[model samples]
Target: MRLFIEVPVWLGDTIMASVAVENVMTHFKGAEVVVFGSKVATEVYKAHPSVSSVEVDESKQSKNRWQWLYQKTKTLGEFDLAVSFRRQWSTRFLLWCVNARQKARYRRLDKASIHQVKRYNDFAAHVLGVALPLGDLVLPFAPHSFARPTLGLNPGATYGSAKRWYPEEFAKVAIALSSTHDIVIFGGPSEQDIALEIETLLHEAHVTNVQNLAGKTTIAQLCAYIGGLAWFITNDSGPLHVSAAYKVNTVAIFGPTMNTETHGWHNPNERIVKLDLPCQPCMKRVCPLGHHACMRGVKAKDVLDKIALLA
Candidate 1:
């Protein structure tokens, strides 16, 4: 049988949805699985053992953007099963065009509050006719090689600045940790400035072996780098969940977002640091008050202390 899967759009969401991927693969066994996703999401699934082909939606909008996209996917022919992790209308329309024999869309449980991984797993279970046990993310590779001991710092959040920790504080923490471990910074194109600022501060502090990989590596390369890290200290962002998938020791700093919903999915090595502010967990892209006390209140030492305990 042939299957088509449309994964979530965000990096973290895609990683978390791997539980469903595993379930679908298990149910179908030898079926060919084709995945549809964004560039980064495509990278996340490219190395999956069960995935046959990955189709990325790299189309930049023009006069006939939807038509172009529809035409691109039309070449896939008929699928036996199609599963979508998103509820958006565009995704629904795409699945409609795929012309699968049977289709399943993700539906949240009524009045239920759970991690996204569980939600994805539930959808897969519903489709597969069994509740599959969720497990750690299934990457194409084994646990990473640790030729050089390193610590990874992810200071930027793609959603917005509200979710990011202070860059200066990240530099301070990196400077302190650099004496014992090599530091590697991670980010996307939008976060290059924050990563570079940390690099400059580290240089001024006479710290060495700091590699600013922000905007320098692709999503696949970033996942490989994350696998090799001794510890990953990051904000509540995409890389944080990536580290969790690799089972890396990660300290996630949470501010405007709730930790329960999006924290590391059952990873024993995961640690979360957040302050209990009145307006915290605001869930805003930018702090409406402009002070950003939720993130600002967290100190570098707090993150370091959490790392110390984990070590």
Candidate 2:
């Protein structure tokens, strides 16, 4: 069967959707599946057990992007199934153009209420009949490549700054834990400053083994590095999810906007720490009141202890 899968755009979304890829492979047993998405994500999963081929959207540069799908549809040959993680109503139109024998998707009321991971999984389970029990959505990255151990320090949250635990606290944790584990901080381009600030904190503490790779490595690189870590301490962010996805032991600190169904994480060796603040988990990236109890109240020591357990 020529199956066409759409990937979720965000990093965590992409990682979570890996489970869908594994589902497709297991459901079909020996059937072949093809994936469509940002070239980056496609490449990340290209070697994965499920994906047979990657068809990058060549027409993305053109102004009429949908036309590209239609064009690609005609050229790529017919597909047996088209499943999408994309929530835009336009996805229906895109899947339709794929000329698949059948079309499937998550049970969403409409374009407005679509959650990325649910949309992807529902389509896989309901449409493709891949209702394999929910497997961890993590990617299989090789942790053995890196010779050194790391204290996976994530300083950015995809939601926004409000979800971030204080950087100074992260530095303090690094200072305390550096003697035990190398503090190898990680994040994205937007989080260079956060990583650097933590590095500065480490410097102030006269600590070593702080390698800030934010904005330096690709998603694949980040995932690989995450595998080499002894433990991870992070806020609600893509890297945190990625770390959990790799099944690396993690302590996902929550400030706001949390629930395991969506953000709490699914890895076995993991725990979440949040203050019992009434106004906590406001779910808003930026708290209305200046006092950010959901995050600010959680102490560095608690998280460090969690990391120790994982280590």
Question: Which parts of model 1 have CA positions greater than 4 angstroms off?
Answer: 59-62, 142-146
Pairing residues by index, what is the TM-score of model 2? 0.87
Residue-level lDDT tens digits of model 2 in 1-311: 77778776567777767766677767776666878877656766766776788877555587988887788778767787777777766667777788878776545533544444555566677665445566676575676455555678887976688889889988888888777678788877888988899898888788867788888997678878887677788887777767777677788888776544455346787888877788865778688888887888888898877766666
Q: Which candidate ranks first by TM-score, i.e. highest?
A: 1
Once superposed on the true structure, which residue ranges of model 2 sit more than 4 Å away at CA?
Answer: 57-61, 108-123, 263-266, 308-311
Question: What is the lDDT for 122 in model 1?
Answer: 81
Clashing pairs in 2: none
* TM-score for all models, in order of appearance: 0.96, 0.87
lDDT of 1: 0.86
Which one wins on lDDT?
1
lDDT of each: 0.86, 0.74
For residues 73-104, could you state the per-residue lDDT of candidate 1 as single tens digits?
Answer: 78988899999898987787787778799998
